[model samples]
Target chain A: MSTEISIQRSVKPLGKDELAALVARDIAPGSFVNLGIGQPTLVSNYLTEEQNITLHTENGMLGMGPEAVGEQIDGDLINAGKIPVTELPGASYFHHADSFAIMRGGHLDICVLGAFQVSATGDLANWHTGAPDAIPAVGGAMDLATGAKDVFVMMTLLTRDGTSKLVEACTYPLTGVGCVTRVYTDKAVFLIGPDGVTVRETFGITLEELQQLVPVPLKATSAVGV
Target chain B: MLQFIDTVGEAVAGIRDGSTVMIGGFGNAGQPFELIDALLDSGATDLTVVNNNAGQGDQGLALLIKEGRVRKMICSFPRQSDSWHFDEKYRAGKIELELVPQGNLAERIRAAGAGIGGFFTPTGYGTMLAEGKETRFLDGKWQVFETPIHADVALIKALTADRKGNLVYRKTARNFGPIMAAAAKHTIVQVSEIVPTGALDPENIVTPGIYVNSIVRVAGTPAERAA
Candidate 1:
């Protein structure tokens, strides 16, 4: 298949923090959320101080907080990405199996994950690329993908080469089928549904302009403002 | 009835060729590096090793695999950027791999310890990973049956242990250690020190003494590393 065609316009990509903030605004208070490693990890940094979201790290933490700030850094306390973090009050630790049980038992209300490509029908291809040198590292993504109540993908709208990551079908090895519920990107936000991808909101572009950046069909529903 | 071995070599003496071993660690955090070093000298072959992250960056399981001792790896994530040995062996068909979803792998080990035959999970449901597995709709979602994973031996690293073999693991370093101790036929633990039986508070113990078969005091634990 031919690669995604990009018609560059005057849109300046949103900074990393903006993309994270956009995702943070949607996580309902008191939601049990698991943020995938990498870009998605930044979402925790943007949540409002009043929100009572319970962050989870599949490695073993249930109520993880932001990166610790102090000379007393306990490197042992880390998120699933193995980055040092501080635990919130009421945080509990358990066996690795129990941690996985929380993930695979459909207990997580939401999971924000980084992705290489996401299909219009909400297929996720984040785990393996099958690159000759790429290591096959399939972690808890599969469990979180299927187990979470709603899966949100936090990623850049386009790859470094200006190719749309929103595709008709994923080329990489899939993590889960029909798992993505929404996507928050540097350019725009999309809701993946049976009717295909719809523009829930855009950063600084019009509906017509946002349509030009994506390879998949963009549906503008009446619920865009909400 | 307490079993405490003095040397890493003696702790791993029971492990044989072609044995399935579950190793505890997420990356190098809780890795029994000293025991792994001792195994390099044993020269065993055709072993099936399991863990979360594939070892990388100059030590532990990565180095052991380079010595041509492991035949297969059954793990959740089997690749790190520096895991060149596994990449080369996997691409060349020299090594085999069984990539289980992380949660599934964790639960399978737990199943073995819990005396459960098998259970259904929705993790791998419509993906390529779920191919040919026995799947049925459970409460409106497709679930696949996963069997328990029992290993011949388990090599685990812990922060501290009592004379009774009660283990206490530190923070994220406690990743797979507890479950692995219960899932293996023989569980060998390497800890910073071995305290007296009553020295450790029962509330602080993560893995009970019942699951541990042997304990070895490893060098360079947190106390040593901090010093």
Candidate 2:
């Protein structure tokens, strides 16, 4: 079945920073958040000082700050992406086991990740392209996907070839099953649950256009508007 | 009692061929480069190495992998911009890879240290990584059973070590040091400073003396340079 969502309909789709700001705005104050590498890392820039969010990096740190500058950079101080980073005032360091425990033990409130594909049922596939000759590297993607209280995905709505990343079912290898709670895309925002995928909002595109791009059926919510 | 050694060569001298070695690092942060170089010099091959990554640029673990010393890599992320050596070896079928989820890798190493047999985790449930593993519905979620990863030798880097072998680390460089120190039969550490027993505060000791077997002072580490 299809439903219509009164879209924001921006002249241009929400840019990377805009999407990050949207995600940051939705995060509850005082939440513990983990931003995955790549695009998800941009979300941290939109998080305001008033938000009081504690950042967790799976490489054994909590209260992680922004990327370090020249004098602040240290080989010993880096995030999961191996980029040198600074620590917040209340930062604490632990071993790898304890760091992963923070994720796997359900201590993290929210985590934003980038995905290759997100199924209607919320299955996530981001780690491996499943290419035969490619060396597969599954970092903390699976752990963060399955372990967080709420998993939000950030990505462009379609691949470079214009194929929808939101699908009826993920064709690539699964990182975690039914783990994604919300999807923040350049074209739209989707909420995935047991009932079905819901179009929370659309950007620079109508609900009809979004449906044409996505293979899965969508139900729209008029909770948000431009 | 922790033996204080002078040379990196003597620190990693006991690692034999065909042993499972856990190298402590999350990238180059806490990697014991001197110990790895010593292992390379000692001509120990056929090693099953465990770390968060396979290797990065052409140094340390990358150098060893380039020299065909590692037979298998048990790690989470092996593909990186500078991981050409691992990529080439893996593509040529000269090396084997066991890619575990990051949290599972860390927890398994911890289980080995904590003397736990096995534990169930929901991290990789219903994913390719959990295939063929035992599954159970516990705590209202499907969890996969994972076993411990014990190491024959562990080479780690720490910021400082006391006469009693208590160790402290620098920031995120503490990644796998404390856990790897306990998970291995013999743990060798390279530290910037070797202080008197009471020099390190009791409350701040990350790894106690019991987990450390040998300690070597590496004079020119970044920690020392900064100090």
Candidate 3:
């Protein structure tokens, strides 16, 4: 039998700046987006205002703008995390029931979420780690993950200890199963396909170099660099 | 008429122990203190309280925790306080604690009010949250089905109410009061002021009188009263 050749054996690494720029480039204009807490929240500030993207918050606010500046902060207009925020010109307020209706009813076009781990099959685990020291809390990340039309993950490729976050399976509690369509990381952009992790681009590193970064086995198909 | 009561004690006369109560608030913003006081005076025990957060210290729900009346608490979190009796009891396995995600807790209450049996959401999958939960595949993704939550007694706060029980809330204090009003079997509201039936504008009434079973007019500083 002929030996199978692995294409991902040679891939490159990407820097953080390149990852953020790639994320910004991919966000289409006029999309309804929900940014998760922490780093995902930063995506709102970087979004180009000319794109006409509307932000929906689960905490009963819609048409959200970037975090407020000195005079624009409204105590009443806040995000799901209870952080003070600014309202867009056409912002509207309603009972939170309607806000969740929009979420569960599949009205959101895109949802970017921060994750603790992403499995090879695109399963997401971001809430609790089940560690004794971990806080027992799972926020709206669950609803946003399952409800949004497209779920995109934003996280570092590896842990502080150099453990690869993109793994064969998640060890932490999962937020959604097979919900992740794309992943944006400090390393490189990857699309989770049925075949395996497909590299869209490696910021500065080569395909072979990037393959070395992940401890898990990766199948590099012809789709690499696409 | 059974409408007006001077003290919270008079309003909570028939309430007994082992009651499942829904306490309104998002954090400590809109808790119902008058009813809590009345429950304290009634010496009710074995309470199952559903609220956004446990009161800070001896302030809101903390009072009940201090009194040793709560047998179980279903809330999002307990903030601003340390050494709470309920926390101690929870740690010692003396009480039951069901912690829910803040937004999910809110949706469960709202769903009960809307008369829906259950709704499917993809919030908690492949985690401990998925354990004992039914999941379905929607749009090529997994979603967990969460059931609605209801309560026997709902305690709420209102900025102003008419004699007929039309209610209005001031600001963020409006958090879960309106929804709890519909989800509870018996809803009792503590109002700062009570006016004539027609005094409140139709547009200003946040909660119509139909869902309200009783009204207690509290006389004190806004901070002295809960909610």
lDDT (Cα, tens digit) per residue for candidate 3, span B1-227: 22667777877776778998898865444667768878887888898998866655566677887777888878765432353666666666676777765556778888898899998766666657668989898776677788898998898887788988888874445667888888888888888899988999998788889878889888763434432
Candidate 3 residue runs with Cα over 4 Å from true position: A1-25, A65-77, A133-135, A215-226, B1-14, B32-43, B55-58, B76-87, B101-104, B114-125, B134-145, B158-160, B168-173, B190-206, B216-227
Rank by TM-score, highest first. 2, 1, 3
By TM-score, who's the top model here? Answer: 2
lDDT of 1 at B151: 97
Model 1 bad stretches (over 4 Å): A1-13, A68-75, A131-133, A160-162, A194-196, A212-215, A223-226, B223-227
Q: Go through the candidates in order and give the clash count of each.
A: 0, 0, 14
What C-alpha lDDT, on a 0 to 100 scale, does residue B86 get in candidate 3?
Answer: 61
Ranked by DockQ from best down, the candidates are 2, 1, 3
Candidate 3 versus the native: TM-score?
0.80
Q: Write the per-residue lDDT of candidate 3 for residues A1-226, one digit (tens) a residue.
A: 1112222342444344444445655789889888887777766655676778888877666698767677765444456665667777887654545566677678999888889898888888887777864435565667777778888898888899988898888888777778788888866678887777787755456568778887555655465553
Better of 1 and 3 by TM-score: 1
Of candidate 1 chain B, the 10-residue stretch with the lowest lDDT total is: B218-227
Better of 1 and 2 by lDDT: 2
Write candidate 1's Cα lDDT for A107-134 as tens digits: 8999999899999999999988878766
DockQ scores for all predicted structures: 0.50, 0.62, 0.20
Q: What CAPRI-style quality would you assign to candidate 2?
A: medium
Q: Summarize candidate 2's per-residue lDDT along A46-96 as a digit string, tens digits.
A: 788888999999999999999999898888888999998999999999998
Tens digit per residue, CA lDDT, model 1, B1-227? 45889999988987899999998887766788888888777776789998886677667888778878889999988776788887777888888889899999999999998899999998888777888899998888778999999999999988899988899988777889999999999999999878888999998889999999999997776423321
